[model samples]
Target: MSERVLMKGNEALAEAAISAGCKCFFGYPITPQTEISAYLSKRLPKVGGVFLQAESEIAAINMVYGCAGTGTRCMTSSSSPGISLKSEGLSYIAGADLPCVVINVQRGGPGLGGIQPSQADYWQATRALGHGDFHVIVLAPSTVQEMADLVTRAFDLADEYRMPVMLLADGLLGQMMEPVVFKKREENGKSFDKSWAANGHGGKRKHNIINSLYLEATELEEKIHERFKRYDEIKAKHTMAESYMTDDADVIIAAYGSTARLARTAAEKARSLGIKAGVFRPITLYPFPVNELREATKTAKRVLVCEMSMGQMVDDVRLALECKIPVDFFGRTGGIIPKPEEILEKLKGV
Candidate 1:
């Protein structure tokens, strides 16, 4: 077992990515997540990896696109607005089926809202991360330990499915400190096949093309259909959630990332007050863990969703439960973090 080390969340995440065998990082400086780049800037070189701070988020994501086409394990990090700037490149990478990780250490935003934690990007990350008929796998980490742990998972998922994967965190997790135990990079001799990569073939095989553009409408549609099949497979196999004390509860609280931690605390408080409140946390945002959520909340009379945004994930919760049970929402937006007492109050009403 590795010794536990106290580290900031963003730095821990960066180091974990290195331990996951990420060979290159291309990113721009953005608050909350800048430490990821800063940490890697120094550490990646020490590990014989490459790190480059691009001129802009757009350039950074494109650089990721270029590197990923060569079948390298690579990633980028940015805050909300910076992620928006990289959206176009994100679409391009998805269309080409390049595997890479993108980390969003979120902050409040429509545009430069503030430098505090926010879950306002739920829609952007899962539904419309970029303009496309595509989806990236999104993982939400609720703890500093998860912030470190999810990096390797993100990279593995990216490689497994041949698509972009996102580690969706926020300022709270990014800036917080916690003790974490990082596993050594697994050195299994086996590697993912990269026969389709655009890396030089040493004149031994035909050139591999990595382009998203399909001039023919039918061809594009065919590619999209194929991709959707992969999405369906991922959804069926990879959806994940944590159901806490939900076996017998009248009220179920739905939350994710940093907000889920608070919800769990509130659930405990509710239990102390003779109220059966369970917390259901979705770990995979894109797959959304709908079936697991339905099972978790099956005994509930009502459901409450708490978030740092104005009811983005609540809609999903409502849909997941199919609206047979009443779903309520409580939120604090514009970079405000809600207290467990607030969630407890909401639970009391439920």
Candidate 2:
């Protein structure tokens, strides 16, 4: 039977990762995301798992790389500044086609930004996170339940594609407590195939190498092309989003993460005032529910892109609709969160 529990988003994410059979965690403590590390530190040992508080975000991600290289399910988490430090390791893991999970409880950014929610890292995540031609599957969870469910899915997708996965949440989601129905544990009896693991093989198979380098430029290009093909398949299969009151609305609000949650409340208030305002929340930030946005724009004449950042995701909304409709932006930054009432006022102006 499924259990109902009240959990903070970060805690839920840790529990979900544990439920998915993740045996290793390596992370540095950062505000808005420290709870995840704390949860794992206490619970992982009891479950015969490992949780290491590395010296730095860079070191933590590298530890994840090492564990994942052994074909063990592993994870790491941090906020914006810390995630920036982890970019190098992330690129390395992507290059090696290693399966691991990285959670970014997003805070304000640029450099040493505040510890409040923000969706400013859209470019950093969707574009190459580090100096490389690689991509990580990025999942944006707006609610506490999704924070849990998506972390589990992130592991499955990471292992399935042999690529890094990121659970992109924000401070509001991290701190908020909500009711969630935890998935019932299932014993599939099928274990992970570790034939490729570097576990001191005793001549069971040929020696394996896990390097990102290809001496031949052509061979490296081919490998990158193949990886992009896999990404294309992932994009097709993993575009997740939610549309509320959008079917016949005159105005649509495009947002994600905490901004989306606030937008929902604003949209409800707008509806009470007889205004046709709706919300479209993108659950997967990387693949981005472009098609859904396109469909919503087909009927709506205007859209308001709200975010904690200045205008990162607004760009995606514009690109999705190709400027077919008028797109306006509302945002706050540097640890300030937008209020739902203010959003409702903005809709009234529209």
Q: Cα lDDT of all candidates, in order?
A: 0.93, 0.89
Candidate 2's residue-wise lDDT over 91-208, tens digit each? 9899888999999999998898888788788889888688888888899998899999999889888888899999889999999999988877567323556677776678878876
Best by lDDT: 1
Candidate 2 deviant stretches above 4 angstroms = 188-194
Best by the TM-score measure: 1
- In terms of lDDT, the poorest run of 10 residues in model 1 is 182-191
TM-score of each: 0.98, 0.96
Give per-residue CA lDDT, model 1, range 1-350, as digits (tens): 39998999999999888888899999989888899999999999999999999999999999999999999999999999999999999999999999999999999998988999999999999999898799999999999899988888888888888999999999999999999998766684237888889999899999999999999999999999999999999999999899999999999999999999999999999999999999999999998999999999889999999999998988888888888999999999999999999999988986
TM-score of 1: 0.98
When summed lDDT is taken over every stretch of 10 residues in candidate 2, the lowest stretch is 185-194
